[model samples]
Target chain A: MKRIALLGMPNTGKSTFFNRLTGASARIGNWPGITVDLLSARILLGADMVEVVDLPGFYDLHGFSEDEQVVRQFLQNNPIDLLCLIINATQIDQQLPLALQLRRLGLPTVAILNMADEAEQMGIRFDAAVLTAGLDSPVCFVSAKYGHGFSEARETLRQVLERNPPTNAAIQHTEFAADEALLAEAEKLVARSVSMPRVLEHGLTERIDRIVLHPILGIPLFFLALFFLFQAVYTLGGPLQDGMTWLLTTVHDQVLAHLQPILPGWLYGLLVEGVYDGLGTVASFVPIIVLFFLGMALIEDSGYLSRIAFLMDALMAKLGLDGRGFVMLMMGFGCNVPALLGTRVMRSRSLRLLTMLIIPFSLCSARLQVFVFLTTALFSSTQAPVVLFALYVVSFLTAFGTALLFKNRLPSREPLLIELPPYRLPTFKQVILRGWHEVHHFLSRASRFIIMGVVAIWLLTHLPPGVAVGGPQSLAGIFGSWLEPLLRPIGIDQQMAVVLLFGFVAKEIVLGAMAVIYGLEGDALSHLMAQRMDWVQAFSFMLFILIYTPCLSTVATLRSESKSLVFTGVSIVWSLGLAWVISFAFYQSARLLGY
Target chain B: MSMVRLSELAIGQQGIIGDMDAEGQFRQRLQSLGFRIGKEVRLIRQALFGGPLQVRVGSVNVMLRRCDAASIQIWAER
Candidate 1:
């Protein structure tokens, strides 16, 4: 099978194009030499099998961004047979140089001008035939949304392959001197051949931007949108969570009951307390993931995400980051691992590093379960959401403030030159598909972590009857107890401290550890912790969870991305110290104020 | 006079930008986004917090740091 690289800037409907070409078998992986993602698929052509690899989007070939570099390096190393440059017809100028460069490479190239419908609506016309004749290659104006021009593109692919042409070495050196005259000719061709309908002149985005970017009101408005998003998720996901929790708990109980008479005590305990309890703790996050993804997909598909990035570009710039860093931070709310991976969008090394450093501060949805489970069992839903929201705000504010204090010469802002695509009602298919993909990835990751974690926890806490001395008082407890005094001001008892010590492995494991520690008897430990502990303790617990050392994978990812274990070590030490100090201060100060 | 600072330009105002000092090594970065001097520019919007300034130049939206804005010299429309 010939390998065909599907190249374009992100959000140019590259994935949609990939899906159209090859169904579910598209393999998603990281691009070599860069963290930017790559998606490739295998499709059977007329006589030969072919592979289509989706290259990360680049605004310009000359620009030195990671995604750009990913595309450049891939082309340099694994030179594909036919280079298919997918262009969003709406924003052709920014992408044109790369297309021209690809053509210059003299590679049998085709320009699939995607989003023709959008371009047509915008009153932009491209003469595909002229464009083709000028570049001496085929140009298919396609709209992946409408499934337009797919057949033509496929036919072109077939014909290009039929030639069985050898790789042209001349195109490789065209980077040093771009054939601008050829590009001009191509532009002339577009002018001659493409005829666009009269655009319905309107300025809805302009009007919305007035309010959304208002100097006095924009920040508040952005926060308001965020507030409503949170409210919608909590208000909607709450009932569904209760149902899910009930189903899981009921199934667990029935399974336990069925096995009670047949199995030995330790074996039954392992199944019920270790496996079911651990998996159930992770599963409880399902509703939050669903609702969070719903909100994210809505914002993303509606194109408000870029505006939000625009809205915060200034503040981010002041902190040596860019607006897109906000997206990484928001994605971190889903899970810090992927969120860190998503930082591939930030082009600068320092900017990427700073964003990665700050992402763990976002209250990820996984931690939301810990808050909801503990707070609702102890406090009201009204109180729980508010507290969770406040914790999120505090963490974000802390991260922002930290960034401000450490203001150094970081990567300059890549001018917020972004194309704000019009808002459209999200397609149910796309949203559900994306949501299912994320949720399944999260669950799969969680399952792996939880199984290993539960087995380890079972070993640490296991002991003979009446021998609490060996199990809970073992090495883990000794270490946690050693730090109890430091944490005492924050009201973390030795048991909670032990769970946290293990939590450094992975945050979700903290909940799993809690479940096992409390013996998983109808969630009695969560209830007990909430009921017996003062609000200060609960608040302290949340605060500590907020800023504690990130999971092992996060630290490793940071080290790999930043190429600095020193920074990783520094991040861990600072978060650990900060978590202790802040929780201590909150608890102590609140106690002094007679809470 | 050299072009006025982009930060000093009014919304909807068009200008011809001159040299930008590119403070903190940001000049080339901004230039790469079509924010170089000699470019025709428009003040799109200014976000809250006295933050980065947003401007449109040749069908693209580019964000400039407030510090970077001070270095951008633009000929404000008379």
Candidate 2:
């Protein structure tokens, strides 16, 4: 299939255009470097099924940033049939030079003036004919935000592809010089093709930024936004999750009942108790994940997330990290996999590594669910939120402290240089699409590990021929007993040890394992936990959970991202060690205080 | 006749970029983002506790570290 690549400077709505053309929901954030990885999908243009690749945004083809390197490497390796050079219409002067550079590569190029509606609103006019003539290519005015002029652009691409343009042989030898003369030439072309109002008009984005980025109010407002986000996650997500759990349990019960008579005893056990119960428990948390992504999508699309980088830059600088690192750390609250991937936005390798190291400390959604369930079960409604909030605060403190401790040990040489895009209210379509994209990504990536984990636990608990499930004679129980001595100092008994061992697979499964081990469900399990453990012991247990080794998927992600087995191993050791010490200290201190 | 480092420019102060004291990749990045010599720029704000300075160049708003900003000489309009 012929390949068409969408290339552009950052924040020009390139991903939106890619999504419109291909029906792929690549993230549409109003920040640079959001598209760090190459995203390709098969898109239909008229009668042809052409492959479309969305390259990460780059300011200059010659720039040496990691993002620029990725784009250059991809273009060099792939035989791109056509290049759709998307540009922000309002910022044509700055954007056109990159277009000029790309066209010089001899690719069959089409320039898309995206966000045409926003430009038009600002009284900016562009003569497409003039731009087309000047650039020696087809120029189409489009509004990826509102879905304008896409059909024309698509038809133009189809015609260009039908022509079967030869690959750019000159690309290998081409020297991209961002000289004054070249820039002036591109500027003159932009001048000839576009006109703007005599008086520049500041729009709603500027008006909002005044307050949002205001020095005193900005930091507080950022925290307030985070508070609201967590509030939504807890308030709105709880009932939805409970309802999902109920529906899944009912389905699971019916499936098991039908399979029991038809299948052998072991097979029936594996399918129903192992697979269904294991996968279903993890799957039920999808609603909460979706809600968290929706909230992040809104924040990201509105361009407030970058402002967070701006606000936190100095604070993070003290920890030898940039504001962008902090943003990635915050993303960890949703999922460590994406957060680790998000480190690609940082320009330096060491900074990326450092940020990756700190991310596991951020209390992810899985851990948050565990905290929510335990705190609510163990404490009154009034005290539960406080405990949950304290966990979050501890998570941040731990991550920051880790960064500080490792600053000198790790290489750190990236300077903070980030774009602060003007804030725009995210469209409903964009928000929902992004949210759905994250949900799909999470399910596809994490479900395998969760299922395998659940099944493995079920096997350990059910195996050994005639051994009772979760009994002392069973494999899991025996293993838990072996670990009991190690955990005794922190007040974690064998039952808690078993649950924590399974929790290494995925944090969400801890509650389910607890339910099975205790032979109780829901409130009964909570009551049982309260009876077996005091508040101090329970709090220490929760603290240990908060800092222990990350889930399997997170470790896998860290290994892949860092590309170092030693680094991944160190991460595990560090977290496990810190968790033990902290829990021991808390338990001992509380006892000494006579609480 | 006096010039000021871009970092020293007061909030809302407009200036023409006179020269950049950076080289290679760093300079290339700044230029690509419309921080080239002779371009008009305005100090939007400085972040709290000596953090990066927010600057506007043409239509793009960017945050620059104080050290990076200090290397760019700007002819401020009093």
Candidate 3:
């Protein structure tokens, strides 16, 4: 199959173009050794089966950034057919040097100048003849967002592929001996080819940034945005989740009634309450998690996320963490597995490792389900969101505290050189696609642990001709009693203690396992949860969930990404220990205050 | 034109970039981003005390730290 590798600098909409062309949300499989994630898809383009690989964006090929290294490694390791480079049309002058560098590689190459719509709005005009002639390559103007210029580009790519064919030669990689000359040449070419109006026409993005990036207003505006985001998540998502749970459990009950007559009690319980109820419990929360992802997608694609990085760099710097790491940390709230996977873009190993340590402390949506259920059952409507939001604040505190503790050991050398791109309201389609993409990843990667853990917890309670379901003679009861002593200081009893152990597989299972272990479902489970723990104990349990070791999927990702057993081991041990001490302190202190 | 550090330039100020003290990968990054000798750059904005400064180099806006910005000498029109 013919292969085309997509390459570009950051913020060029390269991945957007790749997705539009391929129409697939390609998964990032484990590609070891500094290459954490790379996306590729196979698609047929005009009588040709082509594999399109999206390389991480980087400034210069010779640049020492980890992204640059990954690009070089991929190009050198695998033989590729065509090098397709994407450039932001508005920033062609500075970006063309990269185009020039790619042209020097002697590989079959085609260039796409994306965001042509924005370029046109700014009164930036490009002389196609001059651009193509000067660059000495085939280049096309495109706006990936509107799906314009794609058909012609597709045809152009096919023709280029036919002309060059696949040489089947190894593309030897080497640094540019003199990037200075190539850069000079690119500037000279851009000068003759691209023309722009003086004063740059109008500025919507600038006007918005004036308020959004304003020092005092910026931080508050940021918090307000998050506040509204979470509000929307609950107000809208709560009903959808409640409705979904009702529908699923209604179906589960009917199936259970029929199966209870046909199958033995053990088989019936294993299938219904063990598998269906547990999976359905977590599955119902999917809407809320997807909604959270959509909210974040809007913030990210609007270009405000970068503004956040700019606004927050100083504050986080004081805490010994960079602002960009905070972006990954926010992503952790959706799922810590992706958060660890997302750290691949960073150039510094130390910074990446530190970020991995801090991300697990994020109250991911999996844990969010447990917290929301417990809080709603315990607190009134007005107080539930507040309690939930406080957990978020505490999660952040734990992240910063971890950073402060590890900053000396894992010193980051990368400078805070982030691009504050012009704000563009992200399209509705793009936001949904992002939401779907993340949800799909979560389902694919996390479903195994969710199903397996639920079954294990179910079997533990059901096996050996139980004296009474979920009673002291049962395996779950026996195991929980064994763990009770360790957890006693933290105020978690035997029944809840074992749920925490099962939760290690995946945090989503904590709530599901609770339902199964307690022999309760839906409101009854929540009712029991509320009655079982007082405010102080409930608060301690929430802290324990927030600070404990990362879910197994996250641990696997950390193991693979960090590629250091010692580091991953330390991450687990440290979080578990920190969780114990913090929970113990809060429980003891709160008890003394007579709450 | 008297030289001033990029971090020293006020908001809405314009300058011609001059000798930069950056080295290695950082130099290459800045140079590729259109921050070089004789390039016309502008201070788009600055965040609160000792934070990142938003600067326009050619057509691209970059968020650069104050410490790094201070290392670049620019000839400013007062």
Candidate 4:
């Protein structure tokens, strides 16, 4: 298919425009030099099916940044049919030189001034004819966020595609002596075509930034902002997850339970417990991931995400991650699944991988369920919260430990250079669409491993068909028994080892597995749990749960997001090793102290 | 023009960028990011413990480490 590459500077709403044009049809493709996947979608534009690929946004065509290299490499390597150059209307004076350079390339090009709505509000106006005439290409205004002038931009792109301008080596050879004059030409063009007030005052943004980026209050305010956001998630994710669970259970009891007689026993078990349960586990995460992405998109689109980077860069830099990596880590506290998915905000491959490696160390809410139970069982009323708080401190320390370990190894080439765009109110459409896209993204990309991993665990517990589920004779129980010798030193007895197997599938089921192991529920389960393992043993086990590898869905997400089996394996191995060492030290030390 | 490193400018101070000493990609990056020779530049704020400086050139604000900022030679207006 003929290809159109969308090129622009960062924060120009280019990706938003790409999403507007393509909807959810976008597919990710890995290129050789670039670290992140470039999204391309095939769409029919004026009866011609063309692939639109969104290139990494950068400052200059002549620059040597990684993003610039990707843009230059793509042009040199591929036979692009058209170039759709997006420019922010508000920043046209600074952005136009890149446009002038590309226009000089004589490729089939169309320029669109995106964020026209914001520009108009800021008293930035344009003479359409002058801009079009000066650029010697079709220049259209669009607010990609609000769908304003979208069809017009699309039609202009179609018209440019129809003209069939030279798709030549002009882009590959932009090294003319007169290349420096492009800026002058751009200035001349802007002078004729654009008009704006002499002193621009974004009063609201300034006022908001005064607090949001304050020297003393900034960091605390960020946490406060996040606290409120997750408060929304806590309020919303619970009921939505419960509703989802109710719907899935109703399907199981009403739909699958009836099929038990018609289907073979093996088939019935596979469908009812394996596939159905696998899907249920994956579906349960949808509400939280969607809610997270909504709040994340709001924070990002409103430009506060960069502020976070700005505020946290100094501290995060000490750990070898920048401000953006800190954002992903903070998100990991809610759930490692979406947080792993959230690493897309970082452009550098090393930075993304390093951030991802540490994110799993973040003790998420799933592990929280196990901790809450363990703390309540062992520690008294005052002690539970303290123990929980201690676990959180350890979580952060481990995250830092891993980051400090890997920062030098990966060697992040992308420094903390970031553009702090003026904050704007996030539009409802953008937030909703982002949330939907993330959920869809999770379902499509990570759900496969989630289902497969869950099914595999189901097999481990259900196999040797004659044995009862999770019985001593089953695969999971057998494996746990086999590992008991290795685990005993860490205070995780055989039964606890078996429960860890279940916890590996998901920490949510850790408590349930304990109940199943003792054949008890509610207070009875806690009672039996306490009788079997004292505080030291329980503490050791909870440590293992806290520091071990991420759950099945998270593992799937790590695999899909990193796109490297080796790195995912390394992450799993690193966390497992850390969990073992920590648990062992605590258990052995407690014994040494004669606890 | 009497020029000094951009990092030498105090917080809230203004300057006209004179020349940048960095070569190859870094120089080009700084220029293209609107730190050209005559652009009016202002140091908005510095992060704590000698962190990145929030430097505004034209209407765009970019955060960069002080080490990188030191390469940009600018005429101080403070």
Candidate 5:
């Protein structure tokens, strides 16, 4: 299939446009699912089969953000047959540099002036014929949200294909030199077709910016926004989450009853307990995670996310991290995997590495299961969200504090510089598509990893090799014994110690180990531990989790991204040291206080 | 004063980028993105909380944390 790449700046509705062209199924298989990997979908353009690849939205080809690199690689490697370059019409001047470079690359490029409705609202006007004539290529006027000019763009692509276009002979991989010509061409085109005659010189961006950027009140307002975000994640998300859990388990029970008559015990257990229950635990939180992602997606889509970055830039600089660093930190809450993947957005290599080093400190959504499960079991439902929120606060502090120390101790760096896109409403189709893609990814991992994890824990807890009278001689016991000394400072016993040991392999496995140790009710282990260990031990456990070694895949990715064994090793050591010191401090202080 | 830090400057305050004193990998990055001297810049947006400030230079909207903003020196617009 001929690959068609969708290219644009962040918040230009690139994904929205991709969904309009290729539909949800294409995007699910491609970029939205993994968040790290670029995804492709096949489209039938009349008789020709075209592969539409939705690339990460980025500013210019010059930056080092992972998404930008994705674009750069596609350009350099000549992966796609055609480039569908989407530009937000409102920010044409700012976003045009990348367009200029793509034209110089001599790719069969079509420019779709997206968000035309928003542009019209702002009283901006453009002549498409003039734009097309100026760029020397077909330009289509599209509002991806409203589905305008989409078919025309596809037709234009078909026509471009029919021409039997010569493989862009001018497309040589050289920097600045090649871009110089493209920039000149774009400047000429903008001068002819696009006109912005200082319309409303002092607009909303300027008016609202004063108080928002004001030294005294700005920080407090930002905190309130974050407080509301966390509150919404729980208060709004709770009932929906409870309803989803009931629905999934109800289905699981019905399926078990239907199969029980024909199937044997092991077979039934394997299907219902091993696969259904385990995967259900991971999938049960989909509603809350989806809601959380939806809120984030909307903010990002509306261009408000950049404003948040703009607002936080100063605070981050105070903490010794830059503005771009906030993106990686926010992404960490989604999943540490992609958060680490997102470090590529940092313009500097050290900042990228620094962000990566601190990412694990940001509490991922998947780990919320462990936190909520532990807190609710030990305390009340009302106290659960607060406790969990506190842990998140601790995690945030850990990231900031570590970044500060690293900045002061490691080396000082330049201030941040980033492009800020204007805010716009994200489409439902796009939100659902992106959410579905991410949900599918979590399910895929659960199917593959959760099954193996359950089976392994089952074997470790059961069998001829199992412990006699359940007193630490089983397979899990042997592993726990090896890990006991290491975890003793954190006040964990052999059993809890083993869970921590397996936590390194995959975080979800920590849940699996708990299930095995405490039976169907994970609360049994939590309640028992709550009696022996006070609040300090719990805090210590949270700290260790925050700063300890990342799961295996993260380590591998760090190696690949950093391309240095030494850097990876340093990350592992520093994380371990930080965890140890924090946990040790908490444990010692607790003992000193007679807790 | 020679140059006030970019983050400390009020919105609409214009200045020339004086120095970017960041180090390590990010230092190399600052060099690559044309954040060099003589570029005209102004603060445009600030977040509600003591967050990053959005600044404009030429045609670009660059967001920097207040702290990083402090690292950048700028002369007031004449």
Candidate 6:
């Protein structure tokens, strides 16, 4: 099938336009490289089903940035039928040069002046006919956010495809002299075709940036934003999570009651106790995950996230990371899978690798759930938040400290540089769509691993005919007892060891696994946990869960992102070593203090 | 008539880029970002602790490290 690549500078509404045309929820963020990977969908235009690929946004085709390289490589490998070059209309002077360069490639190309609404609002006017005449291509004005002038864009695409222009040889010869000449010509063309507002308006974006990016207030406001973000995730998503858990439990119980007599006891137990409960435990976190993504989308779409990179640059630089890497680490709090993918935003491989090494230390929501459950159960309501906050701080410190130790060992590359797009109010639809997409991605990617893990645990606990469930006679029981001595130093028992094993699948399952191991359900499980473990042991357990090896999905992502067995192995070993040492220290010291 | 490094410009100060002293990919990257010679730019802000400098080149705002900024010669507007 013929392909049309949607190419643009970073944060130019290219992904938004791609989503509008293809009806695919390609992630649209106000920051750069949100669409790190090329997202292609079969889009129907005037009865022709052409593949539309959304390439990662870049400033110039000749640039050496990773995203730019991805775009360049893709163009070389895949023959595109039409090049849909999207430009921010307000920044046409800066954007036009790339468009002019792309035009020389001699592909049947169309230039889209995206965000025309914003341009108009800012009193920046562009005469499309003038630009079209100068470029020898159709230039259409479009607001992808509001679905304005899309028919013109679509009609242009259809016409371009019908013309079927041949790819020119100019694309093959990319000399710096030619690029400079093209840029010079582009500068003249932009000056002639576009008119700027006489009085440059100091608009809302600047007003907000005054406070948000203030020398003193920026950092504190950033933390406040984070505090509220976590607060929203826990507060708003709490009841929904409970509702989902309650609903899933009901379904499992009903299914078990119905199937108990029909299926063999082991088979029935595996289906309900193993698969349903295991998957259900992970599933229960969907609400919070959705909320977290929603919050991130809002921040990202409003363009505050880039400012975060701006504010944290100095601190991040100290750890041999860019502010963008810090943004990715913060993203890890929601889920490490996407955060691992987020590392693609970093231009250098070494930087990406180092950032990946540190991300697993962030307290992901799954781990957060376990901490929330334990802390709430074991401590007073007032102390619960403090304990959870302390865990988050520890997670940050661990990630930063890890980065510091490895920064020098890793090969150094480019320094931190980023674009801060003007802040705008995120649309309600976009936020909801992003949230839905995240939840969908999570379920599809993580469910199989979770279910398989739970089933494996079920087998270990249920195997050997006539063996007691989860008792010393079963496989898990034997394994846990054998491993118990190693864990005993950290105040962990056989039950906790087995639950930790199951937790390797996903952190949220530790709670459900705990309920199963202790042969209790719901509130009784919490009560039992409180009665059995002292605050010190509970705190140690939380610390271990906070720093231990990432869940199976995260490890899989690490393997894929790093594309090295050694790196993945190192990640696991490092995390395990840290968790052991830290938890041991905490437990031992607490005892020494005679608390 | 003095040409000052871009890093020397105060926040909100405007200038016309005179010469870029960087080479190869770094130079190309900056040029691609609308920092070509004669392009008008304004220093938007500087991050704390000698972090990146946020500069407005034409309509686009970009953050550049102080080291990179120091290499770009500009004629500051009075």
Best by TM-score: 3
Runs with alpha carbons beyond 4 Å of true place in candidate 1: A1-202, A317-322, A345-348, A408-425, A464-480, A521-525, B1-8, B16-40, B66-76
Docking band of candidate 1: incorrect
Worst 10-residue stretch by lDDT in candidate 1 chain A? A195-204
CA lDDT of A60 in candidate 6? 79
Off by over 4 Å in 6: A1-202, A248-264, A411-413
Give Cα distance to truth, residue B41, candidate 1, Å: 3.4
> Going through the candidates in order, what is the number of backbone clashes in each?
9, 0, 0, 0, 32, 0
Q: Flag clash pairs in model 2.
A: none
Better of 1 and 5 by TM-score: 1
Backbone clash pairs for candidate 1 read A1-A49, A9-A57, A105-A171, A127-A194, A314-B52, A415-B63, A416-B63, A417-B61, B3-B74
On a 0 to 1 TM-score scale, where does candidate 4 land against the true structure? 0.60
TM-score of candidate 2 relative to the true fold: 0.69
Tens digit of per-residue lDDT, candidate 5, span A1-595: 5667788876677767886887644422423222334545788998988878776667777665545655665555545567889999989878777788778767678888999888989999988787787776788888998998888888998887667543532235677345546666877999999753222233555555566556677667767777787788778877887777678767856766688778986567556655566566656566777777766665556555666566566667676666667767887777788878877766557777777778878787667666765676666777777788788888888888878877765454654556564434456787777777776776676557667776666666554442552247777777778878788877777777766766777676666556655444223445765775666777677668767875777788889988989889987888888888888888888888898
DockQ for every model comes to 0.22, 0.35, 0.32, 0.33, 0.28, 0.33
iRMSD in angstroms, per model: 11.9, 10.1, 11.3, 11.2, 12.1, 10.2
Best of the two (4, 6) by TM-score: 6
Candidate 4 CAPRI grade:
acceptable
Q: Which candidate tops lDDT?
A: 3
User: In candidate 5, which residue ranges exceed 4 Å CA deviation?
Assistant: A1-202, A248-271, A465-471, A521-536, B1-54, B57-60, B64-78
Chain B in candidate 5 has what TM-score? 0.82
The candidate 5 chain A region of ten consecutive residues with least summed lDDT is A27-36
**Per-residue lDDT tens digits of candidate 3, residues A1-595?**
8888899987787767887988743544444343345667888899978888878778988775556666776776677888899999999999999998888787878889999999999999999888877677788889988899999899888988898767575565545334335556777998999653223223877888889999789989988988899989989998999999888878877666677888977887887878877777778888898898888777777777788888888877776667788888887888888778988877789988998899999888888988888898899999888888889998999899999999999887676677777777666787899889988887775577778888898888876684677778888889989998899999999888889998887887887798788766787777888888887889899999999986888889999999999999999999999999999999999989888
A68-181, model 6: which lDDT tens digit per residue?
A: 666666676566788899999988999889988887776788999999999999999887789998777899999998999999899989988987854432244455346546
Chain B TM-score for all candidates, comma-separated:
0.81, 0.93, 0.93, 0.91, 0.82, 0.93
First chain TM-score, candidate 3: 0.67
